[model samples]
Target: MQIYLPIAEMSVNLFLLVGLGGIVGVLSGMFGVGGGFLMTPLLFFIGIPPAIAVASEANQILGASTSGAIAHFKRRTVDVKMGLLLVLGGVVGSAFGVELFGILKNLGQLELIIKICYVFFLGIIGLLMFVESIRALRDIKKNKKRLKKRHHSWMQGLPLKMRFRASNLYISSIPALVIGFFVGILAAIMGVGGGFIMVPAMIYILGMPTKVVVGTSLFQIIFVTGTTTFLHASKNFSVDIVLATLLLIGGVVGAQIGTRLGLRLQSEQLRILLAILVLSMCFKIALELFVAPQEIYLLLRRI
Candidate 1:
């Protein structure tokens, strides 16, 4: 059935929206990532206005993340203290990101900027994850033992050190704060939960345990995306509540399924799968940048 998105001023297939949510929700559950990286691009491909897509995706992420985080909490895999610190930084970053988004939209470069950011970040993250996963898998195959815990690095020497007992690390909060800030900015600008970036950063940069990383990332994403949703609704007025509602219904269920599946898979395998998905998205967006458009100019109606 077709449904009207009042804010977007468009009609779309209801099933299609639900399906998209389901797909992203599965990813969100499986990787403990919000799945916005995948959803936002799909929205663009389907002709949703960039601003509307970003704003609505943020709202959708809030629901998906909440479901996934609760599941992780039950497993006792979340680092609550760490997640809160990240949220502190994310809030500040999101505020700046919203203002910047408004400026870019006014300049008529929002879509291009969003696409460019997607391609750039996805390419870097995908390559890193792919290479790391391969090495990890190879070591496992060779029966080589891996370190149970990461050693102290430069990051550990930084100021504001705090103990994250769940992850069993004494690390500086500054790094975590910085990471959250950047992820929040990306989340606001790109309409993602920032899980893809946060997951990897938590793993390699902070040396957080794989078991806890996804849950912690999801916890922070909830607040960041929630803040973005409100800002977009009040400031940009681009959020389509009807669209977000449809997506949430499907996404919530999909996330539950994905979370269960994640428990059965090896960490390396999950990272590899996520990397492939990221690279695929990066390629798609990059291709659009080089490909010629069917129409060189768009005609807008005058009020």
Candidate 2:
């Protein structure tokens, strides 16, 4: 059966829509990402308008992240101190991003700009994660006894340093704030929970453990995406509740399954898989732009 998205002004297969959500929900649970970076692009390729895809995705992520975060919280992998700092920055960034999205929409550059941002960020982050994960795997395979060591980073010199017991590190609040802010902006513009960006940043830059970062990233995504959803609904009226609801029905269940499966895998394995997924999404979306147009979608507005 097909369902009409009032806001998107298109009909999509109900099963396909829910199935996409389920797939993304699994990734969200396993990787501690909201799966927006992946889902939004998929929606675009499937004939949804870029603006509608972005706004509706934010709504769906709110539901999916909430479900996934609960599982992480139960495991005690969340760093509250770090999460709070990220949230503080996210609020301000989300507000600014909503405005920017509206401005771009008016200028008729929303689709192009959104695709460019996705290609650029996904390529960089995915490549970095893939390389790092491969090295980590090699060390494990070689029976290398990796000592727990904290090396000095320039970010450590920043002011307002604080200790996070959960991740077993002391880092400056500045880095988290900056990362959170950037993630928030991406969340609003890209309809992502910023997990794709935040997860890697937490691991490499903030030096947070992978386990802790996943839960913390989810927590931060919930708040930032909530703000993004409200702003898009109020300002752009682009959110399709019907579409979000269908997606959430499958997403809520898939998340729990993902969390359980994730616990069985090594951190390096998780990172490598996520890296490949991100890269795959980037390439797929990039191809959409160069390919000749083969489908037509009509968008209607309420009079």
Candidate 3:
């Protein structure tokens, strides 16, 4: 069935949209990402406008991450204080990012900008993860215990520091705020939950325990994505409710299935798989920028 998206002003296949959502959701559950990193591009590939994809994906993330956050809260794994601090910075960043998005849209540079951002970030992140995971995998094969290297102590040290009992850290609020703010901008611009970046920063940069990092990232993401969604809907009017609903249905189910599958896979394997996926996406998007379309041949004949 085909459905018209009023906001996006496009007609797309209903089942296709649902299937895309499920695929991204499965990746999200298995990899602990917001899926926006993958989903937003998938939307573009399927003919959705970049602005529409970003806005509607935010709504999908808000729905998908909600249950995860709630489950973490119930389990007492969420660091509420740190999460709130992240939210505080994310709100401001979200508002600013929305404004930037609008300006880029009006300037007719939105699609190019979004794709370039994806290509650049995904390439760098994917390469790093792939290298790191490969080493870990090799160590496992050799039955060698991985050495625990100390993390970088380069975290910021601004004033107004507080203790987070859940994370068991006595750090300055500056680092968390900064991380949240940067991610908020990405969320508004990239339509991601920002967990892919947020989780790593928490564990390695902020020195937060791995136990609480996922839950804390999800908790902050809920509010950040919510703010971004509202801004996109009100300012750009790009959010497609029907599209978001379809994605939600598929994402919820896919997540459950992915979680079960993830448990059966080794962590190193999963990281390597995800890294390959990300790099593949990055290369594909990069090709779009350089590859000439078939129509170019017809235009060249005139020359």
Q: Write the per-residue lDDT of candidate 3 for residues 74-167, one digit (tens) a residue.
A: 9989999999999998988899999999888877777779999999888988998899899988988898986443345654446777898998
Per-residue lDDT tens digits of candidate 1, residues 196-224? 78877898788999999988998899999
Clashes of 3: 0
TM-score for each predicted model, relative to the true structure: 0.87, 0.84, 0.92
Off by over 4 Å in 3: 145-157, 292-303
Candidate 1 regions with alpha-carbon error over 4 angstroms: 148-152, 259-277, 299-303
lDDT (Cα) of model 2 = 0.84
**Each candidate's lDDT (Cα)?**
0.86, 0.84, 0.87
True-vs-predicted CA distance for residue 202, candidate 2, Å: 2.5
Between the candidate structures 2 and 3, which one is better when assessed by TM-score?
Answer: 3
Candidate 2, residue 221: Cα displacement in angstroms equals 0.9
The candidate maximizing lDDT is: 3
**Residue 159 displacement (Å), model 3:** 2.4
Per-residue lDDT value at 131 in model 1: 94
Q: List clashing residue pairs in candidate 2.
A: none
Error of 1 at 158 (Å): 2.6
Ranking by TM-score: 3, 1, 2
